[model samples]
Target: MKFNWGNQHKPNLFTLLFLYFLIVLIVPLGLFSAYYALAGNTNQERYLMRQAMNMTTGDASTVAQALESYRHKAYQLSTNPLVVEILKADSLEAESSQSRKLYELLFTVMHGDIYLASANLVSNSGKVRVSTHVFPEVDDLRYHGNDWDMASIINQNSQVSPTASLISIQSHRIAENGRQVVASILRRVYDQEGTNLGYLVVDMYADALSPQVNSDHVLTDMLLVDTKSFYATSLVHPERFGSFDRFPALNTLDGNYTPRSLPSDTSIIAISPIRGTGLHLVGSLSSAPFFQSMENWLSAFSTTMIIGVVLALGLSYLFSRSIARPIKNLAKRMREVEQGKLESREVSSAISEFSQLEHSFNVMIKQIISLLDLTREEQAKLSEAERKALESQMNPHFLFNTLNTIKALARLHGEEDIYTITVKLGKLLRSSIDNRESEATLEQSMALIESYLTIQKLRFADKLTTEVYLDPSCKHIKTPKLIIQPLVENAIIHGLEPKVGSWNLSVRVERAGERISITVGDDGVGFPPDRLPDNLDELANSPHVGVYNVYRRLFLKYGRKLHFSLKSKEGEGTWATISFPDEEAIKEEMQ
Candidate 1:
């Protein structure tokens, strides 16, 4: 057979196979290689920076625990009644004896914690009344006005009852040497009558926090900085104490772990604040080691990817041949089927999946023919059922009775207005019996209400008066049919029928924001408060069927998108309101 080279229906299988191989293998590999080359180094750096932050967070937690323990112990010593009495003594002899007793108490408390350098009870007169160390250094300590500034160090706002104060960390000068760091906790002492006696100070050496804040990694270093931007202690450079100009950005961070890039030596710094002490633990790590590991990983990955590409090319050729052969055979069979040759020989293939495809095509054609016959039969049955349903809904007896009543009214009254009312009554009865559609425009529903009220006005005469107020903008909105009529009927029967005097009924429709509300109110005998149901479920089994029917229909049609309410007072009045969202109508208008 001769091949038609210009035939648009025929495609060259070899060319199609090569294009498939490129899309399945080469394109994806090229995209992945480009992305890896662009983002590999940046992603690795972010991961390493996160690791450094995690290390600093763990170290900071340990230091915060240790400092909190010291604050609790200091609170106990400061509030002791004996210590307060000693600071308030009148005579020198009484003061001397109480001072000895206070010294014994301090020694017993400080015996377990060797890191505590000194504990002192300083009187308001600027005298060291009691202390763990005799002749402790107190001259260099700064005082604010008549009170020591150290008194503010204790956390006075602690949530614990009898609020414990915070421990303040400060650098104190020692004689003949440089300033040494100390964690000072101070609380004011009060007498039994709530009199201010003096202040208590507990000093802990800052060196005690060195081990917890120190990092063992060779490329990493840690430092502890106080809230004043002064170095409390340093594991890397001890001489940098009292100076924080090296890390100027350290003061800006809060209690969370934050990472910052350093210009010096291309290092990354992570800092986390220590709770209760107003200090931060800063960790720094050099980026050189992290970059070296990334380079090594890239070299090994590139070699592996090269081998993978070579293997993929060889396998792609074999796979393309296997897929292309079956597809070519299937296409030829499809062209035969297009020419109306339904009895063609089955197309066989070496591949199990392709063989299954051939079998499925044969079965589908037979099913399509059978379904076409079934579809015609179903259409005939559906049309017949629709006709029967329409016939059953149109009741001839109700229509005949309504027409006969209108004839009697026309003959007996002999009034021209009675003819107009009968015409409206006919329209209302016809609309109610149709039941072809479940929804009508707001205007159509209002017309039905107008016709029904016109007929009722003739029956009740001067005893009944009705008012209707419809917003011009909401006339075109759609609502469930017969919803308003039932509510109006219920209002007439239950609310206004039993009243002795003239009854007034009002129907109002208004649009507010995205919702439309309809209210039906009557100045008649209202419902008793105790007889009304609380919700729709309770209303289902109640005696009020018309109101409950309208509620159930609205709920089923709109779900939670609509609101229905009824309010009444026994001797005053009754009001029924229905509100539904107008979003769908607004959207249609915009379109």
Candidate 2:
């Protein structure tokens, strides 16, 4: 009701209200706008980059698995009985018969993968003996022409070996499907006597090794790089195959492709190698779209600020005191939060808006604390899993050599029993090799144990007798692998093998009130009480390394809940028992 609008000398309510609005809203909004225009974009880009890299990691694993599947196919081709018989054929009748069988086998392998264009058993003499694709007929023989210069490619490969295969970066005609197969996986097949019978030539389509990356990304380029020859083939663009000249940023053609910089427009580049093979996946994401998104964001910010300013121009005089105090209080609390003071709580105001803001802030703090605790637990679980994995590893080469020897001996002596034992040994070795998880069902652990004991019983003949018993109720209970196997192994190796006469070993798994108990005992020589290990550290230095590993893994997994007892007396017997609560019991305890 006052007439202050005409006077410029006296302090007016409009001017004071406008000053308050500028102090309370416009200054802070200006800072917020500047941060959004600059630092916010930088942080968002980094976050997006991290997300893209995570996706790249997953796609890399998929590509690695695909390449591994190809390697397995090559192994199957090498070990096929028909492949050897074809090399040993003495007459045209036998050769033709074996060739048909070889063709069928190749077709079976090729048909499983849609991208496999052809699979062939190529002779050392450059003859395409058998092929999955239709071989052109030249007079009476199949196509003998080096249509893809297959002969020169074979001889030029210096890294083809019994253990290592060579991948060539060359285009092959896919006559059947009319699609181009730009690369070949060539593996040298050799007999047990080290005789090079022939090699397997598997031609795959250009996109066979391509990781089906997210379409959100601008481009994904695949390079098939031979692990031995350092040959790289670009799958996305065929003309750039086998050379890094087109990619000047990467200085070398080697598998270790660490590029200093890629194309200028690429915001991020992720490089993942197809393990155990000659392929590397290179993913390029462009920055153009990110810039476009920021442009839209800026436009939205400008519109929002314009609306806020217009509303403030009209409403400042009415509610300046009501809005400014609550906002300042919230700002103070936020600053405390920024300084790591999560306990600071602001009192609710008489205004509903400020009261609601206070309530939401408190709820957000509680959620943050809850998430931190959950993250810590997950991180701990991950560490334990990694430890379990490290403990399960062994020198795979030793396992392979031992199995190959057993297979060779079984073939030479024509012993079905030895072959059966060899097969069981393979199962045991595979179980140990393939245990990537931290825990297994009680039944799976028992199966691995039975396989081990079966092999032992076959080896010891009349000298070993082993019994394994499991309560029917405990089959589905979760237990870590290597928990029972090492104990069983110790019972057999240290308990029975050194015994002079026939010895007996027994394994019993039964459920106690709220826990599962596993006992492995043997009627064999026992360690002297004085020589026994007192704790985990001493156990590591003792002869029972397997026992040490089991104890360490269990203690790390179950913490204080693990119950282990190792008792033995000289000339009596050795018995080791481990008991721990099952998953349900543990969950109840946690709750």
Candidate 3:
């Protein structure tokens, strides 16, 4: 008998040489090509992100410059002898002719901003000497102490360098048009000792500030946010308002551009704060195009390497059949392990080294699977315990007392209406207690809102009217149940219940691309921005707990895709907006 090696045959050398050549030569070249492409693409992406951020910063600076120029012009108007004479006289009656001439001169010379709908000379004693546009009637402009209150200026005891300040210009033009108006100004008049006597109010039409702005695309959209509510005036589209947050890009008070959103994607945001004011100009650009090109090139290189490996293996098979067969079996076992099958595959190779390796891998896989199962069980138990603890935190007795009050009112008034309210309340309580799903369809949420609103309408009777707008596309999308009802309830009890007017509670749902937006607004004495809660925890601790509750649930379900915000001006009304991801995106997130 012929002497037999491990393979029961002698192996040929040519095939092995080819395999070695492919691995050593072709694979190294492929790796180098991949590295070069990725490096070039990454550099390009960095350049693009930088470019966009620079554009936003530049646009913001332009707006700041324009306002600064306007303020300087107003200061120039403030210095005219005629203006000082009118202000010093105290009462217009003392120098009415001079005051009139002074007003006319200032208006003609300094009405430079296209957005400056009107200019005024306001006295501390509640006198508006002049106005550009007369509304309802020109003489109708009478000073009320409230209208003359200039909270925008830090009333110094003496004159100082002029700066642009936010103020309300008393002009009928904006008031009659039902558009909001706020002034960014040049200067305030002062006495010899620098005491503030009056202000040279340069009123800007909020709507007119972006001449091209329309309801659909307000300029407020492109704003970068900071501690204060100022935005990048130039980056904003003419119609989109409050659509972008400067909070992420730049600090309105401190100009900085730090990197944000990377690894998965890279982009840079730059913010430039106005020198003295709480305004930030922000800009952003994505490095996606550059990165995508790099990914494609890298993938092509990987594919070529895989092809070369296959060709080398084909050439080597005959010469290294015993070694190659055992290696191929090992690869198949690894694929099964990777797929989580974690089971032994048949290994009939006669090679002792290969047989030992296969047995060892099988034993390790079994041990890992056993440990993974135990970990999953422990995690499940912990999650269950946490849920039970949180569920017990809600106070049931407090709800009982509030319900008793409803029954007492119904009996005392002899009204059947309270019976209907009690029924709705019971259903609401039941839904809140029992709904177990992390999220529910918008239609289900809307029903919950309707029930809550119905109860509110009966309780307030003549004091409230509720309107609901559900976008046609968003009805079947998923969001946490009870998310909207609490906000509506808060609006009614806190916003409308105390006000005397014909209160209007409006709830609107909208779908935009991948987002589902909900708005709740009320025509009642709005909460002051200063008085609003600072964070979710503060909101929960205060009377606005309902708003906080909705906020918390949103965070729990959607993370960053859910957003909550409030807009308020006292005596005007309050508007609250909430946004969530659309249905398809929400489902993908759940998976």
Best by lDDT: 1
> Predicted candidate 3: what Cα RMSD to the true structure?
44.1
In model 2, what is the error at residue 318, expressed in angstroms? Answer: 4.7
Q: State the lDDT of candidate 3 residue by residue for 34-54, as single tens digits.
A: 677657666665665465555
Model 1: ten consecutive residues of lowest lDDT = 151-160
For model 2, name the residue pairs that clash.
none
Question: 73-100, model 2: which lDDT tens digit per residue?
Answer: 8778977877765654422243566656
Residue-pair clashes per candidate: 4, 0, 11
Model 1 spans > 4 angstroms off: 7-15, 26-33, 36-65, 85-104, 116-168, 172-182, 187-200, 206-223, 227-232, 235-240, 248-292, 321-591
Candidate 1 global TM-score: 0.41
In order of TM-score, best first, we have 2, 1, 3
TM-score of each: 0.41, 0.46, 0.35
Q: What digit string (tens of lDDT, one per residue) describes model 1 on residues 330-438?
A: 7787777666566535778888999999888877766766777799999999999999977865676667677768768886889657776768877887787766888
Q: For candidate 2, what is the lDDT?
A: 0.69
